[model samples]
Structure formats: C-alpha cells, structure tokens
Target: MQIPVNQKFRLLSMLGEHISMCIIGVPLMGLSLLTHGNWGFYFVLVLYLNKDFLNGRSPLKRLLNTQVQQTTDVPANEWQCFLRNTTLIIWPLEVLVVAINGRRRLGDYLANTHVANVSEDIGSWKKELAAYRVTSYTFYTLLATGLYLLLVHTLFDWLGF
Candidate 1:
C-alpha cells in the first residue's frame, strides 16, 4: 500500500524512536552482562513500555513535534500510551501491519491512539532541526555504543574469554 508523504515521514521518525532506544539499550545490555544481572534488560523493557511516558510522545516524536492522541483528538493519557506500545512487543507483526496500513499500527488501534503532527509549519521543523540536544544525544550515544562494543570485543578476544 502507498502511504502518503507525511505518513512516510512520520514512519521514519518513529523508526528513529527505535534506533534512539537501541542507542542506550545496547550499552545497558553490555552493562547487564558485565554485572551479571538483568537490570539493564529490564530497564530497556521499561523504556520501551514507557517510551511515551511523560508527554505522550517518545523522544524522537518529541523532537519531531508529533504526539499520540486519542482517536477523539485529545492527547492520549499515560495508560493509552503504554497500551499502544504493548503490541510492539510483537514487532514483526506490528511492523508488517504498519507497512501495509500506514502509521497507525495494531497497538494504536487497541489503545485508541493516533499519531498527530503537532505542526506542519516548515519553520517549526527547522526550529526542531536546529535543536541539537535530542539529535546530538542520539547520534553520540550510537557512536559511543559502536566504540564500546568494539572495545569490549577486543578485550574479550585478547583475554581469550
């Protein structure tokens, strides 16, 4: 199915949300391994479940000025946000549905949530694009995680672990 240009943009931004989570999650996984505990995995899970925790938007969505609202066109409550993400645990199915059905995934239906573009103003987008705080953190964390994994692999190989 052909998604509209704006939906495609929103989809990409949402994908970045997953990437954003992995940026921190990988290092946390590494930590959990070294510490011999499941804390890091649990933390990542919590993050996924609560991606829209405080503001009904994930980090990437917040950066892009989008929001998850009820189908009635009000900002979704915390529970709605949480409910929507629960279906994401079955990522393959959710992704498939989204690819065929556009930006509203299965979870969105179950939770009665909808993705809303907060502003269509090019100026608003430019302003967000200029905001380095979110973008930089995601980029740098990904870079750092790459370096971290490489270092850990080298150390493990050197030690014959």
Candidate 2:
C-alpha cells in the first residue's frame, strides 16, 4: 500500500532519528577508544534504550514536532518504548519494514504505537515553521550527513587507517 504523505514525513523523521544516533554514536565511540573507558558505550546504550524519554521527547522527533503515541492516544509508557526500540538494532531493516507497513514497523506493531507529527502540540511560532517542507528537507540533510560520518567510520575501521 502507498503510504500517506503525512506518514511519509513521520517515516523520514524516524530514519532521521536513526541517523542522528549514528552521528552522535561514532564520536562517542571514538572517545571510548581514546579513554579506554566504556562510558561512551554505556551512554549510547542508555540513549538507545530510552530515546523516546530523552527529555520527554526523542531528539529527532522533537525537531519535527512529532511523537510516538499509543493507538489509544495515551503517551507510550516505558515498556512500549523499550519494545519499539528493539527494532532499532536493525535500523535499515526497520526502514524497509516501515515502508512496507506504511509507517508501522514491526516494533510499532508490537508496541501498538505510531509516530505523529503534532505541530499543534508545540504551542508557538515554531508550529508555523514546521508546516514548511523545507524543515523536513533540512532534517533529511542532517540524516545524509550522519550517514556519511557512519560510512567514514566504517571505512577507517576496515582499512585500519
């Protein structure tokens, strides 16, 4: 089934979140190597597990004025957050699943939640700005940059350069 345009935005937002994690993670991984400490690993582990709760919003979702909500319209609880985030371990496959399921990835199906672009929830001129498609493209640009960083990290590791 063809995904709705709005759902497309949400899907892109999800992908942006994954990319953002990688962008943030590679640097922290470097720090971990430098210090010979697992601090970065633990930090990212917490973030990976509780992304939806980081300051009451997932970073990328907040940027897009979107949030994950249960089908019943309640805020997703911690358990739901953990369940959905498990799929993030295979983020690329998660994107494909979201595309095929029209925005509901396997974890979303299990968690019984959906990502919503709730501009009205922001309550400011920021809501007006989010209405523009440029904002989404900007997010996509950030995602591309994050992917580039991840690729470079992988190449350097593989080449031992």
Candidate 3:
C-alpha cells in the first residue's frame, strides 16, 4: 500500500524508536548476562509498551514531533496505549500490518488512535530533529561502550589475566 508522506514520517519515527531501544537494549542485555537477571529485558518491554505516554508524546514521538491521538480528538489514555502496544510483543505481525496500512497498525486500530505530526511549523521540526540527533548519538555511544566492556571481559577470561 502507498502511505502518504506524513504517514511515512510516522512510520520512520516508529522504526527509529525500535532502533533506539535496541541501541540501549543491547548494552542492557550484556549487563543482564553478567548479572544473571531479566530486569534489562523487562525494562525494555516496559519502555516499549509505554511509548505513547507523556501527554500523547513519548520520547520517540517527541523526537519526531509526532503525537498519538485518538480518532475522537482526545489524547489516548494509558489503557488505549497499552492495548495498542500489546501487538508489539509479536513484532513480526505488528510490522506486517503496519506495512500494509501505514496510517494505522493493528494496535492503532484496536486502540482507536493514530500518529500525526504535531505541527507544520518548521521550527518545531528543527528542534525535534536536533534532539533526535543527540539521542541517536547517545545510544550509539552506549552501545559501543558496552561492546568494548564485553570484549575486554572476554579477552581477560580467555587469557586468564
């Protein structure tokens, strides 16, 4: 299906959210491995599920100047947000549905919400874009640091040093 230009931005924002989570999550996974706990996975899941909070603008949406609002012109409540995100647990299906319908995923349909750009103002978008760059850089730095630590630990173990 052909998604409109604006919907494409929403899709990109959603994808970016997942990618950012992974950037932070990979390091958390390494920590979980070293600590022998599942908290890292749980923390990621919570963040994913709650990504529509903060007055209809989650971190990812804020970065992209997008907001998830109900079709009724009201902010989506927590229940709606959670219901929509439940499909995220089975991400392949969620992504497939989104690919088929850019305007609304299964979660959006279920929750009666859709993502829209917050405004047409260039200034808002520029500010959000700047923030997005910083967020991306931070995530990359954390991922790289985690990888380095894991490598050093492995090397020490291998050499018995």
Candidate 4:
C-alpha cells in the first residue's frame, strides 16, 4: 500500500518526537555530568541510532499514528533504517532534494521508504503517558542538561571568553 504523507501527521510526529527526546535527554545530561561526560555522548549516540525510524514506532510517529515502511510492503531492515535516518543528519540537503523534487527525497527514493498513517489508537496513549511521567524523564534530562552546561562552560573557559 502506498503511504500518504499528510502534513498534519508529519507535524504531529515531529512534535511528539521532540517532547519524547526532551523527556529522555534531561536526565541523561545530569548523569553524564555526574560521570564526568563519558556517558553523555554515548547516551546521545545510542538514542539516535536505536530510535525507530521505520518500524520501532518513534514517540512522534506513535502519537501521530504514522509509521515508516518500505515501498514494497516489506519491513525495513537495518541498512534501510540507517539511510532513512540520514535525513536527520543531513537535513538541509534532504530538504533541498525534497523541495527540488516536489517532496520526494533521496532517502525516500533510495530506501524505498515512505511514511504512512497507521490505525490511530494502537495502544499509543498508554505508551505516551508512561513516557510522560516525570520520574521517567527526570534522570535523562538531568544527565543531558548537566553535560551540555559542562561542555559550554569548558568551551568558554578555554577560549577565555
């Protein structure tokens, strides 16, 4: 089935993903600070790589009832996942491609991946609520924020600014 990429669905997915990241990131920052920065980069890297861009159903996609799928009706594999995520890393280029092609970009074309709306109430509310609980987010945010501050401070101090 061809996936329809509705603008509203895309926007909702982005918002949900951002909120989820913030929920996880804050405590990650704090813990990184406590550990002297070693875990910070690792945390960020793991989160980015392991985040479900195709079938894992990222928080945003879950909220929007959307999912990324292969054009062929087959589930996405690891390489497809990596390529699809490249859009996040090189977003400007991806955007340029999408704009030039009228919304079809390299990642979509090459990976045979497209975003489609799934059935809206697929147990998503319970998952999101669990994710939203303050306790679940606190540790991650603290770790991420603390490490970010530490890095900023170190950079300024080194530059004598």
Highest TM-score against the true fold, candidate: 1
**Rank by TM-score (best first):** 1, 3, 2, 4
List per-prediction Cα lDDT, in the order shown: 0.68, 0.64, 0.65, 0.58
Give the Å shift of residue 16 in candidate 3. Answer: 0.6
lDDT of 1 at 122: 22
How do the predictions measure up, each by TM-score? 0.69, 0.66, 0.67, 0.57
Candidate 4 per-residue lDDT, tens place, 74-153, comes to 54544555456545556567656655554345667876876676667546545644654344334544454456457656
Candidate 2 TM-score, true structure as reference = 0.66
**Model 2 misplaced regions, further than 4 Å:** 1-5, 54-56, 122-161
For candidate 1, the 10 contiguous residues with the lowest summed lDDT are 120-129
**Tens digit of per-residue lDDT, candidate 1, span 33-128:** 999975686578667866875446676776777777877766566667777876655777876777887778888889887788765342443463
* Model 2 Cα lDDT, one tens digit per residue, 13-73: 7767778888988899889989987567556755775687422257676767666777765
Q: Between the candidate structures 2 and 4, which one is better when assessed by TM-score?
A: 2
Give lDDT: candidate 4, residue 26: 77
Best by lDDT: 1
Model with the higher lDDT, candidate 1 or 4: 1
RMSD of 2: 11.5
- Candidate 1: residue 111 Cα off by (Å): 0.1
Candidate 1's displacement at residue 88, Å, is 2.1
